[model samples]
Target: MTAGFFEAPRAAEFALRNVRVPATLAPGAVAPATQDGHLDVDIAIASGRIADIVPAGTIDVARGPDLRRSVVWPTFADVHTHLDKGHIWPRAANPDGTFFGALTTVMADRQANWNAADIEARFDFALRCAYAHGVSAVRTHLDSFSPQAEISWPVFAKLRDRWEGRIALQASSILAMDPFATGEGDRLADLVARHGGQLGCVTRLAGEDHVGVPANFDDYMTRVFELAEARGLDLDLHVDESGDPEARTMIRIARMAAKRKFKGAILMGHCCSLAVQPDEAIEATLAACAEARIDVVSLPMCNMYLQGREGGRTPRWRGVTLLHEMKARGMRVAVAGDNVRDPFYAYGDHDMLETFVQAVRILQLDHPMGDWPQAATTTPADIMKLPATGRIARGNPADLIVMRARSHSELLSRRQSDRVVLRDGMAIDTTLPDYRELDAIVGMK
Candidate 1:
């Protein structure tokens, strides 16, 4: 029944000694105290909360097993994901693996299937996978186009209640901007507010004209901002999720937020086009984003699979946003698991650790690793407004992931399947759901 590298002590009071923890997670560790971005510490747990943390040998050596410098991380928070659209690749595989292919396949699947029960089954499965992987919180984007919104939002509410104590769940509405220009945005906003969810949409309008930002982009953007502001709800948007160098809606959104004095938090995801813009444009956009206090989350795995993709050509650039530039400008940036086994991305397990690993390589977050690990843990937790979800402090719940990987080199080199996930200082099962369980539901005979 034990599934971790080591089992947590059965007693309510104990300590884990000689563990390496990210310095950023340990509020007490100063820059000078870190050994290459990590600090060796002994953590004492009592009654399901972190009791104390001090230098490696501060606790009696016999109090706990020597972790031998194993890296211990705060359990993760995935701030941007598509739970309603996850795990559809089984029956609705993308024909060409292009952006349009994913869009069309997901739309078709939504129409043909996607009833409440069907969605609840798949969404619950994804959450189970996330919980088992040590994710303490998640914010998912629901496909809120007309009836789909009606169907998906209720299911999300039910699951949110069901998984309340296990994983903190938040949902945001996702659709094209055209709805906001019309009156559908108001209707959707009402539904979102009733369910205590965020108002969101993609910047692109709904039509055959698949060019850059729409000519009426500002008009619709105004509506969306007004809608969110009126209801005191946050905004989570899909911005410029393409490689077309001209897709520059991100800067416009940031500027609009500042101009309107929008008080609610705004989180923009999948800003892939920023990477291809001119240097001046990039700097201007980043400055605007910083001034507006906009948070950015890059979906590296999904962007890589969908962007710069043509039938038979090599992808010249990695399809991620300017994470380093944005971070350097004092903006909060995060990495998240966007789609899991869906048409948009054919592979993911709802594992934020895996997302961070892939992001480190895709965004070149190494060179020092620095505080990049926060992108998955603290950064996303802050974005999701869950202060206690992804932190390792004396008064916080002892929800943590302990891995045998002593250094970043070892952490990133292997999958870390044997890692231990502790919730309330107790080890829970890490077994993933059987894929065969979905065979019947997905029609995968």
Candidate 2:
């Protein structure tokens, strides 16, 4: 009930009675029914760290207790998102729904009103939305190509420092071409490093006029990587975001990282090219990615909206990366809400549950390993390298969301709502919203 109760590294205890969990914690497995259709589990939180999890009935509920009865799971972590562009904008709709059109809209709107106050307000609203939806950690992209990085990057840093107890923040310096040229590479990297941010690049910059300088894709990427290494920062590149079959930038980056022995810190987002690549190429690329330990983050919602409609075909491209194949190859794959309600994506409620549902349906992961929801929820946590979060086990972070659905199929089929959300063993919002509304939105019964 107190604000400090949920802060990190504080020892608080909680009990959840009558909860069902999946049978296996492996990649993809069906969550089994509870033996008694109820579980009495006790969660111990200390110093904002999950200290222990014990049988609920083992502890006496009468003595100084923080307890609740509902399904509990780890807090969600979004490995990729553009937090600075979280607000909705009024602009010419993309009739063609092409990636280029979306990019143009974003560019126009960003140029129109991208300032420190505007960017901070949007990011603050986004962080609040993420917290209300039970997302405790996120890696957000800040467009460094815009001179606004001088304003936005500091806002993100301040927010991260202020909310360290509630969220873990990672700022990605977006190296995509904007108002800046390739000549600004060293300065940009220095700027990001000055603010404790990481390096990010977009392999393909959209536009024609900038083609001579910053438009040089190969040179830009090489410079970004070189600067990243020089600054001792990690890389998260938007490699081949379009559906172009010829875009093999991710493959090249993978090979380069492997050759340089890059320590598995790079994340390649929206490698949509991999979805359409030849089988041999896909295999080789996956192998190289695994060898280099490159992390792959697929943005289903944005990619589905922007790139899938190309060529005007029925049963449009799913716009999802080779998630299953990548998993099989032992590559770390995390799915994120890349853009939320912005020019690039007209939708995104900042709820990762929706993202999980899309993954299940688009990836046909109903029977992944054995359980669908568990895999859908847990895999992303592992991919994001979140050790204290994601699984329902002893000593894990007490950040959890309790859903109304009884089974994985029920949860997925209904897109069930989180009935209760707890951060650090204390409930924040206990009101259980209707999942039926979401079901209707997704065309589910």
Candidate 3:
């Protein structure tokens, strides 16, 4: 009916009447049962928690805005992202839009300008975008190489405190595996533990391109596992992001996880090569992942941008992991917005709704639609270990995204840019930060 269809009342208790929510996201009983995988209910909010749910028209509509069967979703959780490297595209544009270009350009950019202040400014900006778009939790990978680790982790900790209630933040240290083989790995792991962060590294050695898995892959992976085990830290890694079929470290990491019985959780991002591997190989890897209890977050946006690019040829094959197969095997698979406005992705506003819409198209996550939306919401939240987030169940916080779209068709066909983001039963200001705000820092002049 309007640009922003729903507005919560100023009163503490209110009702959202005639709203439709995915049945999977809405837990507990209601007067009217779910139909076609969705539930049409009136949700009651008391003191910022979901108080009750009943069939639409069963509740008085005067308490709050009548949503007219609009689709409601819980606030999102982005489990894989690069906040420390976000919004640096102006000064550090990828030279050729290749993986190599992104890697080298970001390296130079980090070296030249990644002081605490610079990182804090950009990191806070990204968080603001995410919060406004209804993301309640995020796990960002910080570029943690030597001095950068010393610098970025502190900024992340500070931001974690600053954005506490509005947006839950988690950080992971990311660099090449070579550092993990040396003493520097121990130091970084210690820093991560100090900041309550995850220990992470790319599954490749230093100076190695995205070809085959590095020859020392096992040795370095062993070192990384040992470091995490010693510190009692979880692992979040950038694994096999390359389209090169030879870049098959994801399976190895999974196998190693099963062999070592690493105590903490493991979340591996971007396993792009798995899509290109033979079906048997793909199944085997996924089996290993399931056996190891490894959680996978596919960065579809960034993978599509970087995976199959060449200078003067039409690229083929979407660079995404075998999500359908993995899901069939009962593995926890999530889709996330990774590297927003950075060299690896080039574009994104830290918006999870957009990420889900694009993922639906990029990975063909539709046809049946089913519970696939969970990949961007409940599933990622589960992976991030934030159980309280990403679902609209009774007794949970009334953190929700109320959109004009009532069905999956309308939800996917158009971008819900004007969706209302409610945090604790109050609508937050969804205004995105202006890019000009970083003109000076990013050298946009």
Candidate 4:
């Protein structure tokens, strides 16, 4: 447990007066202002709404002096994370440092070291780090295979109530697709429906894994889709997350969604296999996903850690999906720091900026500050379809992040971590638990 970017944040002044931001330019914008149509806009937000947004030095009446240099933008959305299994490296260490190791260790730890309070403490701390880092929403995948959902759902309910206007927390079930074919599906669906959660399963379309993937394969997804249709819930699947070239579960899922005309949103994360697939296969899947209106989340952190480790030769792949290609096909793709300080990923603090930074490097988005904002900030939030959390506009809620960097380039180059996160137009304190103390809990000695 190391305190880096994930530590809790101190309080900030409650109000931002006349902070300057780019009117036309924004992070993750499809393109910069056409014909240099840029405006240095001074915005004032209050009561959870943009009170005013006028060109800088153009207010009709006398305004207060502008002093702070910052860029105002939407707070981020970590679309994919493992809250139930996060911050448990000390309690359970993965000696193999592989995907299988992560799966087995997480399963064992959930049975042994995990309970209500311990899970709540770790998950709450992760949320604090995200909030302080200017994240307004996070969608975490809970370990729903066991009865832990009974414990986890209630804990999240309490935390959601506590963090209510400041942060929007979304939950998804993480289990194999088969069990959903039986009574477990019905019970989980009831909990999910009651709590407004999604129906999720880890699907590995082609082959099988003893852990972390579905052995029932594409057939079981029928029950999953039927259950989602029955309950009016969205589907979130960990699809094609392996290094195997033939693991094309995502394509199958997309095709099925189209075949059945699945009602709710379909979000597929990981998709590591797509990168290594044949061009024909890639194109076919992309077309299907685009036609199906599916959203894809690229998890760079854990994939980088767990993929391509079994080879005797140098690791040729980066353990991520095709970002540029997906965008080319008009797929709604995003990036998230998946598992932090868990067996899946040894490092990460749930900081969206950190994830965005790594995404910039991995996806080669440094040029023109490519659509990084759209993917990291707005895309996932819109997927949740929540209010006051999607876009930055006059009528939208004042859920935004004002960064220390003065411009987009400077923001990326300097990475000024100092930020003021406003939830419904007011100040709030941040969260980060001490990793060293956690080591003692996990028996560091």
Candidate 5:
């Protein structure tokens, strides 16, 4: 298959024959008009951006034949993921399916095994999976607690370079409180600057009894904020990941960002405790988050699997943060694959399509006729600050995915398809084989 041009070619005209464009750009928002469902359109790529999209019949091309049955949508922009952790450890069956058990296993693995080579191998695998799945852009969290920035940072830097053409990689340094206290935090910030990585923080770190290190939480967060400002870097925190009712770290962080006018650079991932909070409190906290311009990310697969309670009890599940509510409040919200084949989450196969499916069920998003799958996929792109992606429009990058299915519901319900993927206007699989055969090759079946 021909890969997309890394550097924009000098070509004046390019044509995509018989491709169906999604009905709208940013479907829910007020944007330029675009025909929905199936259509035959000619996508002209000039200087790496789509120059114009004309009706398919407008183009008179001789080199290629008709591709009338294909549908094309924007390539996915994955807002949140943990490339470092996603590749660590094997997936072991957790009998209890509790968050604490998963945490314990991760800690044990860190102590027992896991080195640079292992981490690099896993990271490479995850990136390959993402590209094959049509994720053109991703924000990945890399653990920064280690003093060996000489080691960890380089791996990520190399990975970033390796996938430079196919994907946009944003590296975030995942700093814990204790490590920052020991001077690793400042060092991490420096490394982030040197390597162009983003700043990340874990407001609470695991203690001996599986409790949070309370004494250092506030002080560490202060340093994190300061460092982010000093480095002019984006701040993303894994705040309030615990199912514990008392975990109010995210609320405090939101208040701090607001007081300091940090703008919209802050992102809070897996604020799972919000689901268990009182309605009034959740609303108030969400208001503060909106004011702070903080983005929120919900990891349905990991949070749902790790936090839910046992038995058919009254309070059965400790659901993820209220995603739909946050979006309604005008706060940015994104869904992420927090872990894949890692100790924390054994289920993810590096497919955001699967992630979206789980998110729809967890968020209970319902339309009058039915749930809107295209909207679900598009919303997260906006949240992640990925402007070029998530929509099909003239002058936009021609990165798109063509699913075998006919409609959004069919795509979601079936959850597996042989997609004819494209990047930078180049067909990922030029063979254009049957969807069923392609599905088997990708192990989607």
Candidate 6:
């Protein structure tokens, strides 16, 4: 709490009464936020779930925490993240800041120091950043390029237990689908099952430029589906992350998933190529996604960091998925914090609201107030399969955040970092990661 926040007279009002919260920030909301008027409501929590919603001044609030003219909203959930490779940007720095450069630098660093201890430290740092910024859940894409997952899995499972009910931690294997031939594919699926994580893949069905058709593409995806079907695990893929218009693997995957009627939830991250496709093609792809019940995870931060640099000339299109079209088609789309201060994206604090702001700007997702907040809240929580998450209704879990900003515009500004995070009605004392001195480790690189 900030200084002078706990005035003795208004101690009761500070918690649940006299708070002018925006009426719109909730799951499945699409209404524009009206600036002139705010709602006065008192929220009551009991046993971790919302006990009641009464008019302000009606509820007894002698025990309310000091909100300091803050707005209360559902805590955020990051649908996509790369945790195993997080917080190593200095050691994984690439002068060019290109996508390929990130891969090269991070792979080299990982092969050197990505043991259980190192990975756990970096992962802990990233999670702390998330917790401090009102994120209660995250789906991290673990580094699964090798058998290292067998080692990393135990560490993540332990943290999942450690942060239980506070921050729901879900993980997936981010690996190439081509290695199924070497029998490593089975091992990866088994690893995910053993840890109860999702099966993930970076589906590279196209070449570097990715403007032309891919050879033996379906064969690769067949193996991916086979593994998912065998293990009954959900599928999350890195699909069509390239900027090329012809990198249309997202469409193919959607059609295939719909046809196969895959049982588990299917999620796709970074459908950046869909932006360049023709309107007809894009609409068809979105329709297929809707039919397959696929959740499109838009990662504005990493895509903005990596895309359009190699084109030399000022790039015409930003690296982003078609959020407007997808939303118009009634498809499920949520924004996420993809990579946090890793080789892929060199800027982040594991703040999902930061990602929400980036998506609002880069994707021009000027969705009405209630709708935009849902991207980070209810929508992603549903995609994460978190049952009691992402809403502030009666009987919903009291996983919430109180920020020093009251208006929707103030929320987007992201200027207020002083806030209280609550899980099941208890305040959390959060710590931030320090990253000041990296000269000895990263200066030489």
Ranking 1 against 6 by lDDT, winner: 1
Question: Candidate 4 residues 1-445, lDDT tens each?
Answer: 2222222122221234345454432322222232222235555555567665655544432333353445677777888998777788877888788888887888888888778888877888788778777788888888786587888888878888888766788888888666676798899988988888888988842224523335556668888888899989998888877788878778778888999998899998898988888899899989999999999999887888788877455667888899888888887888988999889998899888888878877777655655556778778877878644656666677676766666666667765555656676654454345666465446566
- lDDT (tens digit, per residue) of candidate 2 on 1-445: 2232222222354344434445443212223345423334555555444555555555455433443333455677888899887753433344456677666776776777667766766677778777777888788988776476677888888889977978788788775643234557777878888877778867756463111223455555566667778879888777777666777777778888877776538888888878888899899989888888887888888888877565657645887789789877877676777888676787787778788778767677655425334433565566555666566665555677766665555666664454456676666753334434233222333
Q: What CA root-mean-square deviation does each model show from the true structure?
A: 1.4, 6.6, 1.6, 4.4, 5.9, 3.5
After superposing all C-alphas onto the true structure, candidate 1 shows an RMSD in angstroms of 1.4
TM-score of each: 0.98, 0.82, 0.97, 0.88, 0.82, 0.90
What overall lDDT, based on C-alpha atoms, would model 1 receive against the true structure? 0.90
Residue pairs clashing in model 5 are 23-36, 50-395
Q: What shift in Å separates residue 416 of candidate 5 from its native position after superposition?
A: 3.9
**What TM-score does prediction 3 earn?**
0.97
Error of 6 at 215 (Å): 2.2
Q: Which stretches of candidate 1 lie over 4 Å from their true place?
A: 30-34, 207-210
Model 6, 1-445: lDDT tens digits are 3322222222212245545455544433222334533455666667666676555666565746434445677788898998888778767776687777777787788788788877777787778789877789988988786767777888899889988866899999887656765588898889899998999887673123344335677887878888999989999998877777888888788888878888888899998888888889887888888888788988998998888876456656678888777877787789999887778898888887778888888887664544666787878988887756766666777667766677767767864566666667666655465654333433334
Please say which candidate is ahead in lDDT: 1 or 3. 1
Task: Give the per-residue lDDT digits (tens) of candidate 3, residues 6-45.
Answer: 5557679999889899887776746454454778989999
What are the Cα lDDT values of the candidates?
0.90, 0.66, 0.88, 0.73, 0.67, 0.74
For model 1, name the residue pairs that clash. none
| Per-residue error (Å), model 2, residue 174 | 1.5
Residue 229, candidate 1: Cα error in Å is 1.1
The runs of at least 3 residues in candidate 6 whose Cα sits more than 4 Å from the true structure, single-residue gaps closed, are 1-15, 20-38, 60-69, 205-213, 436-445
Candidate 5 lDDT tens digits, 215-254: 7677878778888888788887787776666677777788
